[model samples]
Target: MTALRIDGPWFKDERGRTLMLRGVNLGGSSKVPFSPDGATHNGDRFFNHRDVSFVGRPFPLEEADEHFTRLRAWGFNFLRLLVTWEAIEHAGPGMYDEAYLEYIRAIVEKAAEHGITLFIDPHQDVWSRFSGGDGAPGWTFEVVGFDITKFKETGAAIVHQTHGDPFPRMIWPTNSGKLAAATMFSLFFGGNDFAPETKVEGVPVQDYLQHHYIEAMVQVAKKLSGLTNVIGYDTMNEPLPGYIGIEDLNAPGGIVKLGSSPSPFQSMLLGSGIAQNVGTWKLGITGERKVDTQLVNSSGVNAWLPDRECVWRCNGVWDLDANGQPTILRPHHFTKVRGRRIDFSDDYYRPFANRYAKAIRSVSPDAIIFIENEPRHVSMKWGAQDAPNIVFAPHWYDGFVLFMKSFRSTLAVDFRTGKVIFGSKRIRRSFADQVASFKQTSKESFGGVPTLIGEFGIPFDLKGRRAYRTGDYRDQIRAMDRSMRAIEDNLLSYTLWNYTADNTNARGDQWNDEDLSIFSRDQQTDPTDIHSGGRALAAVVRPYPRAVAGEPLRMAFDIKKKTFFFEFHHDPAIEAPTEIFVPNYQYPEGYTVEVSDGSYETDLVTQTFM
Candidate 1:
């Protein structure tokens, strides 16, 4: 097969045409291949538990082939090939793991053989290997004199949480260890304070690390460049804020600098080779005086550490000299530090995204660039801005916590005042507004580039007491149906939260342990029983409906009449289908409905037009 060349706005073959991706995230395959709950506290290190070791490791290559091939059979056209920075850079600084890179390439080639396009995503969790996710090596923390082992001993929330394993999609950015890792990266990678002499062989620590990160990704691209079905690249997964300003990398005043602060790397240089006067010295990595700060100590102590003095470095504040009454530092840290917002000004986001886009184009010019934006980081409009050939990949989640009744069962909350934002009507409005904003943003940011719904999904384990009591599962299903209706109305492409099990049969992270599979893992169920269903419906349906201008779509199922086989005019006002798949039951109308063919009868339970 010839290599695929993506030109202009659409994802096309050698022949130019628009393409929509129907896919699932193989999230746990590369790094956290095992279940999230079983993840060990020792970073990627093994504790011999049999469980944690497998987290994110590719299942046998043949198993991967089977998984990818099955997805193609299901009509999925793309795969978000998740690879972590640690998996490829674990050999330490400046070294790319050749064998690991090859391992990823083999999977990509196999996926292509199944006609699945690959989107290389450098996935990370808390931050790095030491921070409880597959990412940069444990040695990354050592660069700053941080002892990973000590963090585990004291139960550092950044490295290990205090209570239960906070499941995926639950840990809020403002208040987790993930934020700490981001801060460290901001300092080390973005050129914050460090000892003057502290350098990686004369190069700053941050520069060296960024170089390694870029190289690993470049290598992954180069190795798979010949694969036609490999479609795109997601540069970094869920980037978090660090100890510097949220806008530090592109702040108006400029990126934060640590001026003369003592860096651990500098301290190491002084200790090893650099000779300096011993009298005038600094005991800590930073010399700034302490002040009242809301910053939670990673050590869990209330006392302040000098290095943590620059709260603005992590929270996005600046000292003003306009009035000039006096020079004063301000407290910008929030109770939700990870929730600290990055300013959306062009000066900030444009540079941030463009940098990554440029890096991607440098390595894989023919690949379509899928850019994902955080609903929290900036407004949805942020996705609209920046780069040619970029596709906006925004995530959506039904505020799982607010509606969560127990560990298992849950429901969707009311929209406006509901607990979580994603599933509510208000969020639906926001999503609509974003679609408009993205269209406008694309014009300004990426030259009217095509966009897609990058991520969206809800859990399926709606069983047990919690599910039955609140009917949370059912409500969530209804809300999800409505959500998909909206997406379909917009004519957007999507890749649902995930594929099969991850051991914990939870939401997007399930390791294929439950009945969620389209193919039964059970020996009991007959393979030919179409009713022996896989939960593929959750991932398959496009939420909304689409129609050409001046042409509204017709209704197939009628809710008011409670019947099927009834033909009706299209309703342009409604973007999503009023009628949802209740499952199993055929349309009430006498006409036999063919779902695969979009034909059904009435008092057809026909819903509104898309």
Candidate 2:
């Protein structure tokens, strides 16, 4: 469990072995609060936001050993650990929760004891818990003159608490194109230019927002500053550009359209209390469609505070005509600056990333920075002047399987092109090629840095929760195996979507009705068995070379055969043997191994073949 450093396209250990890191997102429920039972399904909003605590997010101190031991046994040496700005600064701006910071420090220390390494992921969904996702605190919107409670009525954003139970499936993502999230993100990233008139306490919105967010993370860095296992920090999880690059505000701008879908201009009008006939969309086997139009904000509820005005209106993106109707004054306001077209990744994301990288590295100079690109968009090209020691950490998902919660080995969709490819072999190739494209992007865009699939997994409660009822997980296994093959074929490093300690069959990950977690308490039928609650272990706990002495040329594992193969050209400069993880779950009956040249020893306790 030595510290790792970046070596071009590979992560090298203290022994100079090219390390292939396999890890998982520590847990999914870290998105919400632990107290007041803030699970999205509960629909409770009485608790004060400032008084909330995240002391026991991934797990409590006493339960750390149990979760960590399980993860270590599963052969995970890395973690894309989840944290949130709300957890750090929910009390208000510059009001650091010292107790929670101490709790996080203890958690990181315990993880180090388990031989696990991790980077802090400032995880977020659309924007915040009040906006149908989780990341920023509620007060963030308040400072910018937003009333989160009015979001639901105005169709500014959707919230589980206000939306009530049986929330629409996979609809939370649509919040990105809504009024609440789009406005906040635009203000956070580009308020100086777009919302020139917008300010918080006389400070420019962009500077005011970014400064506080970066400082909140800096608090965590200061707490865990000296811990060697605290490898690095993620800039932000799935940062969106809001309306930054849209050429037309009238056109739809969301990726997954469900329920009432509004254009950027329509969202602004709705937030400003103007009723609009927004299109209602539904997802079917054929894909998304505009089923009908729904009149939103009929009661005329405004999303802004009582004394505040719409930021866009003040900036002249829209205005009230002589007839008291909102009119689009600048349809392409976000598309350009001073008559020059803008690229969201280049103009906005890169500058923020650079600022974030500088802020975090001030604590630990050698700390690696894991960069996640905007969803469905390519990362901006990096030059010699860009941040160093970065890894192109991107996210991918099988759209058909993820949303539909159904899998067929013979059928898969190329989400990039939205075309169905109907063949098992072709589907597998497409999956592998999809991952390879990211690696290629790393070479071209990020100057040949290492690539990590920050997040990807399957829904355990798939096929209408059949497994939960019948206790059969063959479908989940097949689906997970297919995904693992894609990664293994590419020989890429990755952290699986998640493992939530408190996950249940009914509640899923306890946020947004997503059941992507690989572990659930209800599935734990045997208390003594460490692997009982694990949803799909057959494909998950497979053989992988933990450390290669030189350049790894090839690697593969046969799920059916239970046979493993790995090859690498030895480095004469460093004479350390390659280490392979041979999990006992895949080999219960004492297995044998053969090497091309030298003999290897087995450590049954650690489950390693060196």
Best candidate per lDDT, number?
2
lDDT of 1 at 188: 41
Which segments of model 1 are wrong by more than 4 Å? Answer: 1-16, 33-58, 132-134, 152-169, 172-179, 192-199, 246-359, 378-387, 400-440, 462-476, 504-533, 536-610
Number of colliding residue pairs in each model: 66, 1
Taking all chains together, each candidate's TM-score versus the true structure is 0.64, 0.98
Candidate 1 lDDT, tens digit per residue, 28-62?
43554343343432224342222232323555565
Model 2 per-residue lDDT tens digits across residues 1-610: 7779899999999889999999999789999888767788876652367778888898888998888888888889899999999999999999988988999999999999999999999999988998889999989999999888799989998777788878888889999999888888998888988999988899999999999999999999999988999899999999998888888899767657899989999999889888999999998767788889989999999999999978899999999899987789988799888999988888888999999999998987887888887888866878889899999999988777888889888888886777887889999999999888889989989998999999999998788899999988888888888888888888889999999988988889988889988888898889688888988899889889999999898888888888888888999787787888999888887789888887889987889999
Local accuracy by lDDT, each model: 0.45, 0.88
